[model samples]
Target: MIEVNFDGIVGPTHNYAGLSIGNRASFANAGAVSSPRLAALQGVGKMRRMLAMGLGQGVFLPHVRPNTDWLRTLGFNGSDTETLASAWMSDRALVANAMSASAMWTANAATVSPAPDTRDGLCHLSVANLSTMPHRASEAGQTERQLRLAFPDPRFFRIHAPLPAAFGDEGAANFMRIAPRSGGPAVEMFVYGEGQSGGFPSRQHRTASEAVARRHGLSPARSLVVRQSDAAIAAGAFHNDVVAVANGHVLFAHEAAFADPAALYAALAALVPDVVTIEVPADRVSLDTAIRTYLFNSQLVTMPDGGMTLVLPGEAQENAAVWAWLNELIAQGGPIDRLEVVDVRESMRNGGGPACLRLRVQVDADALAAIDPRFLLNETVCARLEQVITQEWPESIAPEELGDPRLWDRCARARSALTEALGFGTDEL
Candidate 1:
């Protein structure tokens, strides 16, 4: 096997994604490729954005508690999402639930899936967890900028018109959005569409998922429901850009979409101009987590002194030591602004992570320009989303708030404000 020394340029940089993608390879334009699913690739362009990792397979014993020793190898968990403490460990795995204890949380959480729209941090969807959007509040340049988010009441439960069911769950927005820290506009996301199988939650899990969506003022259709397939199993989908630093050729794959692997692989080849497959052996359990997973990880934004921190990848993989490798690189003067690690013990106790809990935005140069960074600060952004109509969004809110519109504004304003202030960057007074 030929080794691509990522330690050179790419190595000295920080990669929150545990992507141990080969560095010696080259890249192909994602546009040149073709896929039956994408009539036109909305996310991709000539210059693409960077993605976290390729396909992932969480290997663990059946009926295993998410984070525990004796699992062997580079320690991983049944669930990808884990607490910050566990995530930053040289070898640790925590359950996503551990990090999600708020009134508005779900069990299906996977990865936070960072995006540039999020201004450069984790894109999450926990209606129960969101309190205040991170902001400087003091002065403009006095504190610099990332995102200007004005959170709305989660109990508001405002509904968007032209319901998802009325149409085919067309314009569904998921919990994904841009990081306000990066100072970008918030982007609507839909992890799954309403009409799809996982579209509208049915059983308890489904209902719970919907409730959280409604609580956070997200569109059900925003989620990517794995359309029925002969492949035996299905899950959600993630759209992201995969840049093969080793190959120079940028391969774009929708990392979020855990639908039909083969079909997705084909679609990726189509949407991406150049395609080099990055595969991890498929295990039924891992596949299940992949489809119905929600895990999130983040790093602290660099301070004025040029220091920033990010939540690290807890467990280690054959080549996926997101924490160990990056930490060492930073210590070696990797040119990183700064890095911060969180325990997310609270989130893990509830079952979630920095990654699985949030959302992201489009990083494409052209698409990014059209967006107004100020939208992140709109006090009514969340409420507005509740009322806006989009072919891609869903017609129904989450079950609890499904038909009702009050749930959107129910979150305690004072409590939320305090939590968000601390969550983003505000220090104790």
Candidate 2:
């Protein structure tokens, strides 16, 4: 099976509103001016890098921002412009939530079980309710719509609606799959947190993880539900991906990532005996340094030549501690043989890294072909996307400009132009 990395196109409304509660970078960069055009271009550059590496690459379009429809449900009624203005006057925070571009972090879009691992032999995806944050709760419906359009063939895909909001599912960011290789039966690990930690709420509930597992028909023996370390969460590791990431037979994580690392490692070893774990000790890179630099958030992808590469954000390269440890790991000839750093400063400022920006899906040849062609990326597609972004996306957006009707109109038109450029209809996206 070919593993495809479907990245969410950075939206025109991309801003530093600091909507996420536990994400330190988001809070630190809140209210700062953002470069929407640069953000989108950077995301496209990442996709292009993946393509150049001979990996399957796809795109998930941005959602309609300044969600005036959601405001109507909240008792604001009028034309879109009028509603937005009134909502802005009544509650600036509400308007900010409505205009959030957090959906570009596609890792939180859904939890997917590939065709090889499900009982029905079809890929199963459950849209995350994201109930933990008010700004993110409204994404489920639109996310489900996009997933359905991308994987329409019932024979190869089953898209489930978001679980009830009470469960508070946050999707693939808190989940990991370990197999001998891609496209094979593997052990699925669900990392959940309990109670509040370090003044931040633990987003993924254990019950929610169980619900997704059952919905996907995963057997108990192959599924392990574990707890995320309170220390890590308190350190601002809002999602498990921030502290750990698994690809193929390797699990690269910070030492403080899980509550009981020994047991989790033992369980994984039992399931996949040859599992290669590269755990970075706190002495080398403290939890604070790891979270601050997003050292563990790198994309640990298997290259076409059977070697693994860590696609890290530029932040990791800037920090002396993080960079030294990575260099040492490479010098020692660890599972991660090479490092490739890409600049996603706009996203990094908003608390998302390379891994958070994309959703990984493993699909066989037939299932791969079943996906919508427009969502797939190539050199031509990337060039067209770059052109559209340059021409249409806003150059910069300050916090005060979020409520501007003119900005809203530009954002809408940018999405429209993107849709047309991709040969999608107005209603299709």
Candidate 3:
């Protein structure tokens, strides 16, 4: 019963490339961060970053991470990052079965958080036991239902065995108790929470979220919570939700990883909606690792033709005030058609863009119904990697082209604050 929906997105390939180690690892070249059309869009966002490691971050293998000059200076091209990187690598699933990846998490105890379920294609969410992974308990040999699905699946409802400590969650596997509420099923959805394995001060994540709300019978104190806590948020950051959306309406970002940004914005305004929050103050030079990365590096998507596409972080105005208030709420009606960000911070900074790194998975409404907006409006991989960097440095022998033209006009106003935060229309990118 893992149908699934939450606006899934996953990657920031931005015209990716493969082979690297330049500047003289023996001059293998390539490296300015790969091109030839961002290595065909990093072979398709490396397949939704390997399905966003099953909605968490247990990424068993995933490798490759070049950056593609952050999608060739923002405007994508090379065919809209190769049509969303070759449809996320023709729907991946084989890097030796994504390195035998594992996932699971369950804990509703009414509404402490973490639900989204799935099975074979991996996404269970919380079950319990501990020792994580198929219940890899202590490992030496491994069993307990495979170490309780091996990590992740935190808990669902009525679990025990020393598991909860306010979800300080030691290696979860799967668990959930939600489903009932008078006719049991749809809780209208909306929980946000993000600190302390969350489920809260744990009673085994509230007795496995009240035994998955009494095995789908429902009613756990009405439901609906919106936290952002952060006792350091680990168990792989409480098994990330990849921008959740099972009709829950989400948009969470609580930066204190360094500690106290107004107590992580009052624990994310007590849990979501001020328009799904996106304050981003990271003390000053902002971007809190792109808010712990909005699902494997970037997204807003919904194209095919109707509209809405922000992808994010490749400076067209530095999140242009969050894509110009989401392009004026998509010009009042809010049906966004295109935005796409992706930045490598001018080629490597302590962070990348859109959201530091990448992760997320699941997407197939017939390949997002075939997105477009003329595919990030294209100009051909930024006019072909600016004609291969002024033809391998020859504007008469580069040296930053002999220096200032106002340092290329302050690097074009710090790249126009990330291309005016991506509202587009600088004559259509």
Candidate 4:
């Protein structure tokens, strides 16, 4: 099966409101001016890079911003503009949550099981509830709608709704799979965090991960659930992806990534006999330095030429320690042969890196065809997206400008234009 990376386009209302409590960069850059146009362009640029490498690339449209419907549920009433104004006056934080573009981090969009690993031999995807944070909790409905539209063929795909809020699910960010190749039986690892006092909250619950594995029909023998290291969480590695990522048989991670690394490794080795474990010890790279540079958040993807490549953020290159380790890794002639760095500084300021920007779906030829063609990317699609972003997206957004009626109108128009350019009807998106 081939792997397709579906990236969420940065929204017209993309800003730094520091909504994610556990994300260190978000808090550090809170209230900073955001350039929506630049953010969208940078996202499209990443897509272009993927396309150039002969990888399958797709786009997830931005969700409608200034979610007036949500505001109405909070007791605000009137036209969309009027409701936004009233809500802003009463509770600015509430309005900020409504306008969030967190959906751009599509890695949190869902937990997916490819056909090769499922009981019925059909791809299964469970949308994440994201119930931990208030701003993110409101994303489930829209996420489901988009998934349903993109994967309409029930014969080849089954898209399940988000789990109940009681079990907090954060999707693929906390999930990993190890296999000899994409089109084969694999070991699915679900990493969760136990709640603790006096630190950032643990978003993914053990019960939630178990439910997803059960719903996906994954075999008990091949499904492994483990706890994320409390130290990693306290160190600002909010998601497991922030500390570890797996592609095919390679598991690249920090030594302190899991609560019990030795046991987890033994279990994984039993499941995949030829599994390659590339561990970066704390002495070589501290967790603090890793999180600061987002070294582990790099996308570990298999290239069309059958070689593995790490798509890292530019910040990784700027750090001396991180860069030294990466260079040494390549020189040692390991499974990871090369590194390709891309600039996503706009998204990086809010703590999302290469791996955070996209969701990886493994599909065979027939299954790939079942997906909506409009969602897939090509040279023409990229060009059209770039044009829409350049002409419609706002150049800059100050924190205080979020409540302005004019800003709301621009965001709405930008999304509408993007949908039209992508051949999607306004009502469909």
- Stretches of model 1 off by over 4 angstroms after superposition: 1-259, 275-277, 283-285, 288-342, 362-429
Provide the lDDT at 74 for model 2. 97
- How far residue 108's Cα lies from its native spot in candidate 2, in Å, is 0.5
Models 1 onward score TM values of 0.30, 0.99, 0.22, 0.99
Encode model 4's per-residue lDDT on 381-406: one tens digit a residue: 99999999999999999999999999
Model 3 Cα lDDT, one tens digit per residue, 71-102:
33434346433523432344221111111101
Candidate 2 lDDT over 70-183, as tens digits, reads: 999999989999999999999999999999888999999999999878888999999999999988999998999999999999999999999999888999999999987534
Off by over 4 Å in 4: 181-184
Measured over all alpha carbons after superposition, the RMSD of each candidate to the real structure, in angstroms, is 20.8, 1.0, 22.8, 1.0
Tell me the lDDT of model 3 at 180: 26
**Whole-model lDDT per candidate:** 0.24, 0.93, 0.28, 0.94
**Model 3 TM-score, 2 decimals:** 0.22
Collision count of model 4: 0
Q: Give the range of the ten consecutive residues with the poorest summed lDDT in model 3.
A: 95-104
- Comparing 3 and 4 by TM-score, which wins? 4
How far out, in Å, is residue 240 in model 2?
A: 0.4
How well does model 3 score by local distance difference test?
A: 0.28
